[model samples]
Target: TLSQHPDKNLHKIAHTRSSTGPLAERVRPNQLCDVIGQESFLPESPLGRLLVEDNLPSLILWGPPGSGKTTIARIICRVTKRYVVKISATKAGVKEVRIIIEEAEKRCALCQPGTVLFLD
Candidate 1:
């Protein structure tokens, strides 16, 4: 399990490596279909079920930092097999956001492959 890895000692291997938790250690999801969370909106919401089941759509997780928003988004991207693009409103400007959206929109038929935009 990732929880059991010697993440604390990763500093010895790489000075830039973080040791907060496994959640931030990895990037992108291994499988979107395997994502977990948002049970309350399941079976009812179209987009919610897609996120929890089909692993499709752009996800805008609105909340403060360290709230599992990025973790959940990462999981969804993994299971869905769609391209995952991460961005931060804090660091990005409207032009940058537009560029990312335009690029992500180009995925699949709309514009590559399917995309799961995860904005933090």
Candidate 2:
């Protein structure tokens, strides 16, 4: 079915999120300084430190809609030379997630860098 269950519908309120598609591409920061509008968060702060360390733990990016959660994920990957594979719960199912996960595992195996699995 091309529909979602009530409690799990991400698209029900995709306000500022780009509707182009889910995880269409990794949006790398244009420059180290191009990441704008995050006073509380810094480029090379604790999060930056983690990215540099290449041992970022899994996290649940919680916030109201349009809080730049998606933007931050890309910035994390950019700063770490890492790769983030975002997937929307509404547009994707377990099977698709599993497939991307397998690919991510391969990317991980090489110790390429950190990968942020952003979900909404």
Best by lDDT: 2
What TM-score do all the candidates reach, one by one? Answer: 0.51, 0.53
Residue 12 CA displacement from its true place in model 1, Å: 21
Tell me the deviation in Å of residue 66 in model 2. 2.5
lDDT of 2 at 80: 61
lDDT of 1 at 70: 66
**lDDT (Cα, tens digit) per residue for candidate 2, span 1-120:** 213535333333342345564532323234434455654455477755665676677866677766666667656655565677767889999998888888888887988665667776
Positional deviation of 67 in candidate 2, in angstroms?
A: 2.0
Highest TM-score, which number?
A: 2
The Cα error of candidate 1 at residue 83, in Å, is: 1.3
Question: Over the stretch 1-120, how does candidate 1's per-residue lDDT look in tens digits?
Answer: 443556654344333444454534543224432234545334466765665566554446666766556666666665566677777868888898788777766665563667666666
